[model samples]
Target chain A: MQLLRSYQLLVTWQALRKKAYLPLMMAVQTLFSLGIVLGYPLLFPTLDRTTIYLIATGAPAISMITVGLVALPQTVGEQKTEGSLAYMRSLPVPRLSYLVADLTVWLGIVIPGVVLGVLVGAWRFGLDLQVSPLVVPAMLMVALTATCVGYALASTLPYMLTVIITQAIVVFVFMFSPLTFLPSKLPAWLETIHSILPIQAMGEVTRGTIAPNEFGLPPGAFLVLAVWCVLGFGVTYAAMTRRG
Target chain B: MLLQIEELTKVYRTGTRANDRISLAVGEGEVFGLLGHNGAGKTTLVNQVVGLLRPTSGTIRIDGRDMIADPGLARRLCSFQAQAQVPIDGLTPRQAIDLLGQLRGSSKLEVRRRRERLVDALDLGEWLDIDAARLSGGVKRLVAFAMAAVSPGRVVMLDEPTNDVDPVRRRLLWRQVRTLADHGAAVLLVTHNVIEAERSVDRLAILDQGRVIAEGTSAELKGRLGAALRLELVLSSDSADAPISPFPGSSVSVGNRLMVGIPMDGAGQAVTWAESLQRAGAIEEFTLGPATLEDVYVALVGGVETGPAELEEARSATAA
Candidate 1:
């Protein structure tokens, strides 16, 4: 009964709190995803089919990552500054329920953009995408892991620091990470970092699921995502439940 | 007692003691006030009771259940209105109140019923559907109060609940607070408003520098002042400091205001002296009234005094 009440409270409160901005956020995500899919090709004179597939599948992953890492942290930081986070903490609900509810809301927000980005990517590139059945679970896992990591960051750090870190993560994901290109092309040390970090794993899983014939599923990718997901949740739980 | 706090102490890592061995109790159906100035640990004590801050030492028990061992139970049993305003930017007052009521485990219908009652009681009918972000600060404060009162648990803790409320609605809000206590919940009101606390609380504890200096009902606390009357002087200018007392009593001066406690028999003398000071252009106005909790507060808190040079200069200027 306690669990049910906690879930109810968190889900409803979170959803309502973001109600005015959800549509705008979804539109922004969709526009951002579309920009990546259609605009990236302008940089390269001629793209190979594999490169096109990578960019196509990469757009959705980046969208999920942006929402999770960039948007979620900013929202949570605002809540912190506004004292709403403390108000929520004072509620009788279970602490973990807050994380679940936030994840659920963010996932709902990211799905429209992901689906549209995938369709638009396939249409623009004229590719017969061999979308695997595991795509749903792959995308959900990527979204969840990104959001949990962001939630943990927002919960633990001061609001201004959280905002700064989130902006830095955006730059890292866009410029340094292997989301839009092959990991082998990067330097060895950075490649190793991507191998351990969840960003590359997120891209790999989504790209592999979307174009099964084009790329083989790395055995370690799912494992990496699972580990990061757990770690993120553990940190977030500790931060939320700790009395200070 | 529904809420019992014994020697509750909270020391931050900066080595600042926000609460120093504070002990108090509030029984069911009572409005207990923790009255203190800013940084006097009133909000700190409330935060600990709601389990938002863990106390460094001592114990807090809600209905004899140990809160230190299980802070979750502390949160579950107490509904708190924090000193900071609750952010409800997108939500309307009705939505915020209803959601909070449901969050506290009330059924939908029950929550709706209680929300309606609070809306009427707090005169929040017009602001019910307006976005809270657009509401006036006082209206938003009323919304926050309704949110807490809608599903007040075994204990309700309001930290400076009347901060931004207007005079007319503040009366309404106080009535609602009384109604909450009358419903058998222990209401712990934390505020520095001496006048409101005196009238609203069944019992109150005056805290200064993290210590409870006095605790009692309004009449009981005021009884300590005997038959003294308070002589208030509003100085003519900010630079004008309080003159040395002509009578045998204590006085507290803050800014351009001065409050001196004089015996009841000295009221006529106090008025004559105040008139003289007014004619000397040292004071803009003066009032003499029965000693209030404010006088007791000044006597206990020993408020800051202007420098001797400043007082002497103002006195010499008045004489000249």
Candidate 2:
């Protein structure tokens, strides 16, 4: 594990050496999150308290989801196409260290977006009155789960196909998913579908912190999210450990 | 033996037998060359030795440790310089060397010492700080070579190490390889460059289509031609149709040139025959020299005159 952490630190340093890209990406994430949370309220000024509360908390969840489902997969796929993945495989380090280090760097990049989105939402909407202790842990789980799923997708598919699939996923999450809006707004049958998807469960947990009384998630939400986390990590591990 | 491989075979799922039953051994402080044309299974054999691919059969023992049972031992014992350069996009040459060395379990002090030595030897001082992506292909290959050599290992496998290197730098690279061997590391050099193999390898194996055709020291392989000397000639346009043999052995055509082996007894007649052909305007150019490693390679892998019956018939006809 010490060797794993050392390798993680080394990889992180090499990856983040160009400081220009990190801040630029952070700015994009912050603005994109702000756009969904603060922009939606401007378009629907007459929305009631619960709908506004859902958007405020769901905005951060969206930021995490986008990073995981789109950015992570795209970056991983690029590494594969560039032969960096093969180079890493040639190293003498432990096989599991690659995953642990890669996830660490990406998670580091993603978790801040969740924080910025949550803080920006609270500042933009003056409605947050209480904060739960579960917010940090919940957000971390969501980001990790999403990133793992993206990594699995990147490994399972070729680069071009991964790119197209990740793009479709980003578009669906941004436009069609009930992440930033109430599930009641969707048709009755569609609501049944989101109940099982990890995205809705993620949003509920994220929202629970901002509006504990009104939008708090039940224990079943965490359980469903945990199941997704286990499945996602299992796939990513299998992909990393696969030998040619 | 520093590295011993026995009956290694790799049968791909597509039914392509990349590496047939092959065996080889390399001792400490020896530079062993694997010579072959493309798709001759040199890389496949190297990959299995390095633990990148599992052998369908046989055993690879490095320093008396079985690599199959403990793949990590292969990593610990051998460092490989692959044919394709490792992608070093964002990192500089120095960082790449340092990172790989450290990842290979070199301490920081050891890494720094090796890095300084390798950078100096490879003449990469100017480009060490530049982004590797911006460097030339040859420079990247040199950096990759440095990365492979920086760590401590008993065996070093260099696959086509001189592909993109300039002549001067290539000489320097061979010097480093020799120095590494002098320091008691067993080096496996996989290349198709016959000239480099002749110059650098202490002993070598010529692989053709996943099988070893010949294995010996350069002098020994060259000596396979016995007392025969090669007499090469470029025939004039008018004389091209007529066979030009100073002393009849089988002549092999390479482009418009005809190369024939002369018995040591017939070698004295070569200069007289060349003079006669020159005066008659039948020959444009000619040279007579002892058979070289290339000659042996041509005879073996090129399949021009490898048969015992053809050799005996050619000798008897020449004697007649």
Candidate 3:
């Protein structure tokens, strides 16, 4: 526990000390999220209940996705290339504890943007947000799962390959995945996969919290996110602890 | 013993043996140097000992704990400075050192004390507040060393710690290395700087092709060359010779430099012969000294210090 605390302090200080990169990355995340919220409204000018729910909930989910799929992996890959990863590995700190610390910093950076997105969507589109009690917990789950998956990819793959994979994920998440749209719009095959994938589940959980009953929030969505969380953490831990 | 490696062997997936049946032990307060040329398996051996690489066959014990079975103990007991300059990103030297110390389980006060000492010792006062990335390579190397020394564990492994350092800072670095050993830490220094090794190492092992060719104190190893000395004579020209084997041994010519190996008994004859050559304008400048770690390394590793031609000349001289 002490080691974890030290890692938390170390990671926080490390991120805070990066005078330029931290703020730049955070700005990109916030603006990207705001862009999604504002741009989607333009596409659906005729206000409807479904569009409003999608904009508010989907905006937050997009922030999580951007952080998880882009910013986190890039930072990790840069560290790996620069030998900081080896420095971290040489320390006596627990491997999982380092991951927890890293997740905390990243989640801290992205959560503000998530809250802002929710607020902007509610204010701009007049979303009658029910704001379920589970919103914070659901948001935490989304952030954790996304960060873990990114960490797993960053730690396990070569830097160049990780970059390529991250780019691919960005394209898939924004253009193909049904995170912001109805599942009926996706082809049967892709929707079948998204049913089990965490992206759509993240949107469903977030949407269910704010617009409960209007959009189906199957208990199974929470189950899917939980399973993904377990899988991500499991793979990341195994990768970090694996012997030569 | 603070650290021990028994019959350690590492065979990569490509079937290249990096360390072959290597065995050694370092006691507390001992600074053991590992000397080798590039691809001599020095780094491989250190990596295995630090738990960064898994040996195919061997047992590594750190503070008497099995490293492979208990890597956590190894991590806690070893502080390593890798060959590459530590990438500090944007953290100042002070922050980096403190963070590493705390991560290594040092107390706040202890970390602060050590950080101050290191910063002072390494002359980091000017660069202490500057970000590591903006610092010069030599400064970065010093900061990395400081990070390693902040809270040294029972075993400290430093790989090429003085690579980019200046001569003045290099001296200070050597003192810090000795200080670590004096504090009862087992220091493993892997470097190609045999000259520095003579001053800093209590004992050393010279590795070649994944095997230890020689291991002993500086005196003991040089003793193997027994009254044998190295003569580095820069010839005025590579022309007419004046009894090339002046002292009854081979004298090989490497470019304009002719290196001759001589025994104590043959010193007079060799000096006389070189003087005659000098008079004849065949020799320009010359130096004679006791055999160095470089000489022993060249003799054992073969052609490491000198080129292929020099090795051939030395081989024929010995044979003759």
Candidate 4:
């Protein structure tokens, strides 16, 4: 077996056993996102359920990605400083495995995010969340891809810098993506920006399927995300392989 | 080979050399002590052995498996008790042991069997139910040691095994190390406390600035000194803290261990020191053992230059 997968699994196990708070935070975030979606029905009762579904799906998936990119790094950074990283390295387990394990656990953390997005969209829009047999397979793809990206980011720079940059970029994109008239109707540069951001891909794909036609997602969004998965994985792989 | 490290060199990216061209071997049933002062590359070498830090160039073979090339196989063969505290604040010591055992692929029955015995031997009974973060630094070090012993592996590498431990427990820790070697696990001990090494180590290596300057058995190393002993004495009371002629010699307290030097040249003086201690009821034990590994260390590493007057000072302080 490749050590990378072993590392990912080990990191996942460590988080489950030692850092249980990570998952609890994920649960809370997902619940809050769901609350936002559910509350929309009462506040904007005039709008049709389909439109409400679109907003709910895009909003929470974006939030989950943002939390994962930002919060995860600070925790990992603290561990590195306290010498836990050195302690684990002293074990027989490969250093790469430790990195992988951390990323894998982060992927598991986002499950609550997905559930919130799905449930909110379903209830508000009256759409079919009746567990598409496809959900599992799609989610599995999204998971491995997200981990490849997250772990890659986690290892590339020092933890604090990664967390800061990740939060700034994630929040900026989330708040501004909807306002970028290009994603719905404008310029080449802005469209290019929308084309590659993982949140945008998530919003487009999720919205395209659940409420239908809100983000004006073209087939290009899937292709862009696929490129990201491949490139994110390559970058992470290259970065970790280069480290001592 | 229990352990065969060949041409192990670690040069950090910043051009600092931590470990430079080191080679070593340890056979089963032997306790090998690696001595070095702080920042002397002792921890660096040990860390590489356990796969904590990758070496710039070299091969580490434990039980005939290359640790760098096949780390998982290496991990399976070795148990590392590091100097740093293990983070298992979420679990009790018992649960921590169980979790580590499971991680090592031990059966539940196997874990239970080993834990029951080690819990008492390491004096972990008092802290079994407590969270690791709540453990005192000494207790946490013991906990780390216990975890190393909790699972059975072919090679055991312990960094500073007796640091912060009481003398009574230090004795127990050395006995446990000897027992581990006796049970056929090659033991690697990294320590700066030469006095402890005097009584315990089977063979030793003195490391200086990432280099192994001297390596040999304690007796072989000490034999180079011809005839001299590192002696230390302790008085029974507070008034005894005042320096006086116990045996007309000198001694110093190195943490809990009293340090003194005895010269064979003054046969009458040595006798007087022993007799005075026995007479005053100040001496708990007046032993004339052969020169220890510490003497060998001072002789070879620091160069032997202790004087008769210093010895007298030590004797009086310990006797007083």
Model number with the top DockQ: 1
User: What TM-scores do the predictions have?
Assistant: 0.93, 0.84, 0.88, 0.75
Residue A84 in model 1: shift from native, Å?
Answer: 1.2
Which docking class does model 4 fall in? incorrect
A129-198 in candidate 1: lDDT tens per residue?
Answer: 8799999998899989998898888887877788888899989988788877899989999999888999
Which one wins by TM-score: 3 or 4?
A: 3
Q: Which one is best on TM-score?
A: 1
Question: Considering TM-score, which of the candidate structures 1 and 2 is the better prediction for this target?
Answer: 1
Model 4 misplaced regions, further than 4 Å: A1-19, A22-24, A27-54, A86-104, A117-133, A178-182, A185-188, A210-220, A230-243, B163-170, B223-227, B230-262, B267-320
lDDT of 1 by residue, B51-129 (tens): 7778999999999999988888888899899878887778889888988888888989999998998889888899999
Q: List, residue by residue over B133-232, the lDDT tens digit for candidate 4.
A: 6777777777778778777588888989888888777787788888889999899898989988867788888876677778888777665655566555
Estimate candidate 3's alpha-carbon lDDT, on a 0 to 1 scale: 0.79
* Position A16, candidate 4: lDDT: 43
Highest lDDT: which candidate? 1
For model 2 chain A, the run of ten residues with the poorest summed lDDT: A12-21
Once superposed on the true structure, which residue ranges of model 1 sit more than 4 Å away at CA? B225-227, B237-241, B279-282, B302-320
- Candidate 2 chain B, which ten residues in sequence have the lowest lDDT sum? B311-320
The clash count of every prediction, one per candidate, is 0, 0, 0, 22
Location of the lowest summed lDDT over 10 successive residues in candidate 3 chain A: A12-21
Candidate 2 lDDT, B95-161, residue by residue in tens: 8888878777878799989999988988889999998778888988898889888985799999899
Per-prediction DockQ comes to 0.43, 0.19, 0.25, 0.20
